[model samples]
Target: MHDTERMNSGEIRAGIGLALVFAFRMLGMFMVLPVLATYGMDLADATPALIGLAIGAYGLTQAVLQIPFGMLSDRIGRRPVIYAGLLVFAAGSALAAGADSIWGVIAGRVLQGAGAISAAVMALLSDLTREQHRTKAMAMIGMSIGLSFAVAMVVGPLLTRAFGLSGLFWVTAGMALLGIVLVVALVPKGTGALQHRESVVAGQAIRSTLRNGDLLRLDFGILALHAILMASFVALPLALVERGGLPREEHWWVYLTALLVGFFGMVPFIIYAEKKRRMKRVLGAAVAVLLFCELFFWQFGNSLTMLVIGAVIFFTAFNLLEASLPSLVSKVAPAGGKGTAMGVYATTQFLGAALGGILGGWLYQQGGLGGVFVGCALLCALWLVIAVTMREPPYVTSLRLPLSPTALRDAGLIQRLLAAPGVADAMVVAEEAALYIKVDTQKLDRTSLERLIESAPAMC
Candidate 1:
């Protein structure tokens, strides 16, 4: 039976299954953020620069490995790919847990990134659902990511308080193992294998992804967002310990407060944007808020309360942009190249993480918090300018069309599709009868799309 025919609870649960699996993977990385630098100064004879390298090594490796893992999932099957990744991640966590030196931890971080399963999970999600409900499925994954990030901020410091960073690693290992169970027992298996070779070629896929002035803007947006995020953390603990007069033991309260405020702050805006189709407007407002916050942080971080306020605004905009960018990618990417586009996007995302860590550390070391915030302010300004240039993303839902014999046999179908007013692009895989089309919301005519498919000549 198709996923739509299943009970709503089951469908939602399936989405949850994917989300939790993703969260398990992400938490391993995020758990170290809040407390590591402060405490890590002593462990493995680390300085801020080495700590930053340890923190970012995962992204460096993840950027390199994510696409290959996803492609492997298409061929070997999602379940196996995920299981292997999980085991590998667990092994890395175990190594980090027992590390005697900074190099050992860095090596472990690299191993952790090597276990890239994000693409596989996404591909599995695509297989488990009908095309119409794919957005909903994807939304679940996105929400989980945000939620996990928020949850980790509050929980990470507390975990450190309870058991130290090594304990965090052990816990991360346990979570990865739990994911193995979820994949094997809960996630349904089908076309989510690792053999989708066409998904990897970076030709039209890379060109389309790169040339889109808007997508590049968002790419810059995320790179800027993550850069600020990493930079802030680099400065935050030192600020809290040295400036805010907070002990390392109590830092979670600040994180807990900022995260709660930020998550709540972004939600209404997300709802408004989606319901009213004001994505561009909402996004613009959010970016402006972000840039101002960076400036605010630069001016006001000397005061503890002002720093808290700045943190809230920074994260508020961070959450909003994180949620919005993927939506825009879905709206803008060529339907035939979504996977490829995402592959490239993922690479950029991880590259951002790595760059953020490296640069953020350098800035913090050279000029203290002021320098870091100045860098963040500059990035936010660039993102603001870039985002301001984007056309509003369409609110129309995407539909994945499976190929039929008739649709394939028609030599002129691609031409007919190009002629359709609302159709942006179409890719018809004759053998698979899988058709991918993007509809322009301004000119959307659903009946025309349906009728064209119904009337097409023999394809098979």
Candidate 2:
């Protein structure tokens, strides 16, 4: 591989540092998911509905603020935005730790979501890495999130068991502090925020991204996926304790088992989806799996063995969809509209979490675990229908290349790029002096594109 294709040590360091930042932040957010339902009831004035609100309150703020934070980074700088967000998160954690009531926990969760720094963090990662290696750097962040979630499921229960919910909140606050240290001491500074169309949302592109039918379907899909996940968790922990005969401390074993089995089970399907170019088919199948799991849980949740089976199946589908959805968004996104589409996608995802938490709590109060399961089943069914009807996504990856002034003026540049093997779409932004193209990497003729750039005529 060319040196350009490989990430240098600086890039590697940046990627690792940023990934840890993401992990720490996400871990703080996720560690409460499993414990809150069972333990949160002890808080004064706790109700199922209020407990659910507390669980998902952060998502509401996160959804609302993520885009603005990204834009803010462009103005004030990435590190400053990150530092401020993390501090806000720490403050929220402290508030929750000291609160004796469910309402206070909800307030804390909202504050936690206020630390909407994901976009800023991603923007910084883009600044620190080269275009060719950008995908790999982003992938590192994605993998860190997955790993943190898995760890959170196990650790949340253990921490809550040992130190209670207050202690858990305190720990999350400490983790947020640790994240600040990582940012200050380890993460390399970027030169400045660059308008990376592929990575940063453009305000003008929002309407167009929202209007895209395929992208909208994907947005709905993520919303539904997370909605189902949040709703299921609202009842799942209690079900495990009440019906599955599992003790609180042993809950980690269930998550650990389910995550392990589900992760391993999801690998081959992911391979099939990517290698066989069967993304739509696999995605629909996963939704169908989710629907089946919900129905299964509704019917057989009273039994320990059956609940475990349902969880394993649910996680298998959940992990697959989680891994696949972002890839689909990337593939379906317009040449220069990826950032906007993803911004919308992310917003919808958080909205789903908020809706799910509230809906799940209400349902749990109305009809207990069965109602929650039934509600999720309906959501899965709707997502499955949407998945089946969506258009097959083009299997292409976006690439951004700096354009020389001569090349920018070349009228035939786009046609030439589209003519290259595997090239599907091309756009040149004169203002930015950049060319954004989508290419099927498996068949892309890189040398031809390089030659065209190398041999471009000079201006008269």
Candidate 3:
């Protein structure tokens, strides 16, 4: 077979296509976060607590459905389910955009959140990319989301002026439509799509994800990350309008600056950590930064500069945690359950978000900044503890090997390949093959993989 046929994937290109779809949907969530509460107060029947509920309601639905939807994608089809979810989300956005009362907005927000597709996206990327490249593909989607969240914070207000609230929904609808086009035009077909079976546990993929301890740690990290995020937004907008002296129309600038500076600030350290194999240390430092920001918000958020300083630190750590957690999850998750693991992880994240908003509103109502900060600090502290204990996963690589029935009979080859140096684990699955090659990053020998494959092509 030719090199192209042997590859069985064009991971980098296909990964980009998948990342675009994810970025669009994240923009949908991020748009309202930085300004929603302050402006939302004008709607008839609005209340402080009611506004907080609205801020978090979307996550409630997303938390509930993320895993189920992902499992569904394994059965029905990724693109079709995603399309349906988008339609529901767009309809909900339109409903909120046109609402005359606070209740209407809440209802619409619920519908909009039902479009949650993060889990399905992860699963689909796993199906499409080779094992060695799967983590990279997942990283692409994660980075897209981080960049989108940062960009949207800065752009939402500017966009609001052009379209108004009604425009936000309409634009959301239009974005969904565009996403549908990408799904149709770009997403590569998956081999698993043809025989993706339905069962109580959805087979090995989900079973493995459920049993992983490392993945659980990462999951806890994400839960804390988003819980604090949604809770902060519940109060930040009001803080800005009241204490910062910023008009609602210009609030995006705060987000724009914080997101940009924080996003850029994180790059050097992230690269250093990843290259030097010091991920655990970097991650610990990031969590510490997040906790410090929470304390800063609690103590000195009496002025715009203080809020902005707090926001810069908050989002810098947020971006890192958002992207790194998934990559870390991939390292620990069971083979083929990339989707299910992410689904569970995302559900936890959304649940945290919903709880954050609900709890933040209640806390603010009763005890103000001290209550919220104490709660967020507890979350960060929990993650920091987990991060410190996390095992530094060796560089694990995945590969795809095409197989037919005839190849299954080549008995000893699979076992022999697994015994090779640097090969920690191997799964010579039918139709697809996976290997978790533990590598010394500084001295990886590509030739071993090639030589091993050449010696036992049929078994591989």
Candidate 4:
């Protein structure tokens, strides 16, 4: 493997551009969550079920379209898919802005979700970055998402108050347009054909991803996490207003406080997990914290202090779990199956969000806020049990090897590569002309590996 350098100016520019693009689009989506439950009630023919559906409709389309959009990007190119997705997203925002009915809003949200460009965007990022710096680039995107969500939680209500819900949707549309401009004007163009195996999906990898028990547990964990998040919002806004005596516009203050505190609180634990090699322990504790927060909300939701405390705990645990899950997935996935593993993880996440909305709305309609809390708590409990089986994520990194077709087919060569010290796993895909390897950096025998590769018949 070549020793990749630190990110250069162009790489930094591309990473920031892509991060902002992702952040802006996510802001458009998340800006509705904090106040939508109460505000959306004004829509014609709105009911709990329909409102929940409207909130979650995007996930349904997003979940269904993610992989296909990713695969399409591989064939046609990333920028085109991204542009089309933003346009669709903008169209959805426009439709929602014009809608007077909840069903219309739902339709628009679904279209917004149908603009599934996350995979394409990530693939594009992978295309432009070096392997060593790829994680940092991806982390920038992740941080953008976290920051966007936090900012949206605070900004969404203020926007709603000033311009009304329709106006907010218009702003979302504008954000999507801005995202398009960024993609065209700022994001760098990659040379040559799309060639990132680490971030591209393969059909053959799916069965193996499914069969990996540890990876399955992590997927289920994300599903439960997002489900609880969507469901909580379905009731949280109402609880803040009716029980806590906070008005709609003031909701941002609470969210701002909780998010700030939770984000900071989560950082130390994440650092501890990484430094101490206790990722599984930290992850399990975070799930347990989530369960406790749900139960606490159920019992003491009416009190302002409890609401604030629960929000703090919920977001803290949420941030911790959210950050850890992806890292765990990367480690647990088979060497060549990161993309397939992530695709499945993402699908489960969206499905969970959709289910949460429906379940929360149904519970609220049937038995109010308390019922919603109880239902979510039960779900978390189930997740905790499953989470217990999740093994510690391997401390490893992925390396891509350029292997010639002939060398790839050489059984002895493949065996020798696998037997190399520090190589945890290796997968050679002849069609892609690459060998994917998982290596523990501290233990990798670079000299020996280099000698073997140099002695090989041809360069890929």
Candidate 5:
């Protein structure tokens, strides 16, 4: 492989370091998801609804502040924002660790969500990586989050069983501190922040991004997916212990088994979707699977065998949808608008989590586990409808290349760029001296693009 196509040592270090930082923070947040409903009742004045609120409170603040934090990093620099966010996260964890009531845990969780550093981290990663390697860097962060959630699922129950909820919070706080250390000691400091529109949200693009019908569909899809996930967990732990006849202490194995099965099971489907260009069909099928899982749970929840089977099926669908949504967002987002579209998608996802927590708790309070499963089934049904209706997404990848001053001045730059092999769309931003394009990678002739850039002035 050419040097441009491969990540160098510096890029590798930055990608790994940033991914670890992201994982630590996400692990802290996710560690409470599994154990909170079961262990939280011991807190003073705890109710099912309140427990659900505590489970999802972080998402509320995260949804509200994520975009602003990304914009803030553009002003004050990435590391400073990251440092502040991590400190706040650690403080929230510490506060939760000492809380004696559900309300206190909710407060701590809200504060935890306030840390919101995802955009800043992505921006920093963009600054540290070359354009050719930026997607890989971003993928590393995505994979880390998935791995952390899986780890948290298994670890949360074990920690709660051993040290109770307070100890788990303390551990979460320690993880935040470790993330701070990684940021300081390992993550490479960029010379300065660059405005990589492909990776960082632009303020002016928000309105148009919102107006996009296709992007809105994707945003709604993520919202429904996470909402279902949070709401399911709201009742799943209880179902496992109360209905499945499993001991609370052994809950980790159940999650461990289901998640392992789910992860491996989704791999081939993901390959098929991407390789065969069958994203729409696969997405709809996954949503339909989720609906089936919920119905199965609702009908046969009392049987341990049925619960395990439903869980395996649910996770498989959940993992597949979770993996697919962001890729769809990337494919469907308009040229130069990917970052903003993603911002909206992420915000909607968090809001869904918050809504799911509240909705699950209320349903569980009113009608028990049956109601929770029914509610999720309804959500899946709606999502499946939306998925099936979505237009086929363009099979293309985003690319950013530095434009020479002469190239920026050339009147026909876009026309010539578009005429290049595999270039589906191209835009040149004079202010940034950058060229952003959507290209079909399979057909993209990099050598042709390079030669075009070399003779851009002559082409005009």
Candidate 6:
């Protein structure tokens, strides 16, 4: 039958290249988050509201076009879509860099966001890797994103100080060009459109995913998390400059220290949730902490010490919630619907970013820092109420095991497979000739499962 070897050289190369590509693009977006609110005032016609809109403008286009771009990739090819996206991103960076007015920057940001290739990129990653090693490949991409965020937090201010905003945009443009070269030179071409049940969204699954309460809840969680994040950044940088008496150049220290504290504080809870299967508890607690951080900042933001404390708490919850929401979505999605579920989840996330940017700007204009924090507090409180009712996610992992077309039609065989030790749920996709199984690895018998799969006839 099938080769079940571990990840080989090609898979590793593709994973690393794609991860870098994603990181470069994200870095361009994130590098503005920490300094934009304060430095943006220097632009012509800049206001608190327009600054927020410019900060989040990319996400708006990204949300609207991701799925359509994914569909285009299916028709044309992944590399073409990816190349076009990078080019658009680079052009947008250049436009924003040269802009003299906030409106020009907004246009550039909108163009930058118009390069929506996340779905295409993820699909290409699925094509380049085997199902067994896909999770590890995706993990690499996720790690790259986290690394980009950390680097951007530190580098945003540094770049602003050293090169100015124009320089930062020029650098981002260069990075996007570099990403294009990496794709052209290093990334392997996909064979064709492969139906990766875990990665490619099926149109039919959308309705089902929407109907899933648990998955919907996870969707809302991601939306709220990103919303709070964007909204916070709108006010946070200005607060640091005005209330904490920190210069724009010195802002990185607060971010660096807070990120470190938050990272360290968040690990134990993540481990506990995974090890003990107490995700609801950890998730709820993180939400509560988010609420507390918002209120704490609203009341004591004038003091540097209190501001630092609030940031640490804010990021701790942010990191934890960000990591956990995707895992819960995977767990809650019905078998064969993981890709659709994630597509919806990602859409909600980008929508939140767009909403957050606009709302943060409007609120800041209306009530300054106090208004922004109060709005975020309410968002967190609502999430907390939602989190309290979420069911504890089961301890299970997805496996795409080989299945012949004939066996896929055998309901009796699927029933028997589900009855097997450690097997929690199983659904066979006949078109793909694979069984998407959710199982507890702790009690699974790999040898027996392999034998059963191998024993099936190749044809009807």
Model 1 ranges with Cα > 4 A deviation:
1-14, 191-204, 415-421, 440-448, 457-460
lDDT of 5: 0.89
Best by TM-score: 2
After superposing candidate 5, which stretches have Cα over 4 Å from the reference?
Answer: 1-5
Per-residue alpha-carbon lDDT of model 3 for 55-133, expressed as tens digits? 7888999988877787688678777778898788888888888888889988988898898776666666766765445
lDDT of 2 by residue, 143-260 (tens): 9999999999999999999999999999999999899999888888777788888989999999999899999999999999888888888999999999999887789989999999
- How well does model 6 score by local distance difference test? 0.88
- List where candidate 2 sits over 4 angstroms from the true fold: 1-5
For each candidate, the alpha-carbon lDDT, in order, equals 0.77, 0.91, 0.72, 0.88, 0.89, 0.88
lDDT of 3 at 403: 44
Candidate 5 per-residue lDDT, tens place, 1-460, comes to: 2336789888899999999999999999998988888888889999989998988899999999999999999999999999999999999999999999999999999999999999999999999998778888899999999999999999999998999899999999998889989888888778999988887899999999999888898899999998999999889989988898888778898899999999999999999999999999999999999999999999888877888888899999999999999999998887788888898898999999999988888889988999999999999999888878899888998777788777778888889878877787888777788888888878876666766866866544
Q: Which residue pairs collide, candidate 5?
A: none
Q: Looking at model 3, which ten-residue stretch has the lowest summed lDDT?
A: 194-203
**Candidate 1 on 1-460: residue-level lDDT in tens?**
2434543555566688989999888888888888777877768668677777777778898989888787676667777888899999999999988887877777888899889999888877766766556677877888788778877887888887898888888899999999889877777656434222123433446766788777777777776777677777777887888777888889888888888888899899999998888999998898889889978877877777887888788888888888888777777776676667667777888888878777777887788778877887888788788888899885654556765676677788888887978787777765456677788656866566867877777544
Angstrom error of the Cα, residue 253, model 4: value is 0.9
Q: Which RMSD values do the candidates have, in order?
A: 2.9, 1.2, 3.8, 2.2, 1.5, 1.8
| Model 1 / residue 151 / CA error / Å | 1.0
What TM-score would every model get versus the actual structure? 0.91, 0.98, 0.87, 0.95, 0.97, 0.96
Model 6 alpha-carbon miss at residue 284, Å: 0.5
Q: Report the Cα lDDT for residue 322, model 2.
A: 97
Q: Is candidate 1 or candidate 2 better by TM-score?
A: 2
Which pairs of residues have clashing backbones in candidate 2?
none
* lDDT tens digits, residue span 213-268, model 4: 99999989999998899899998998998799988878999899999999999999
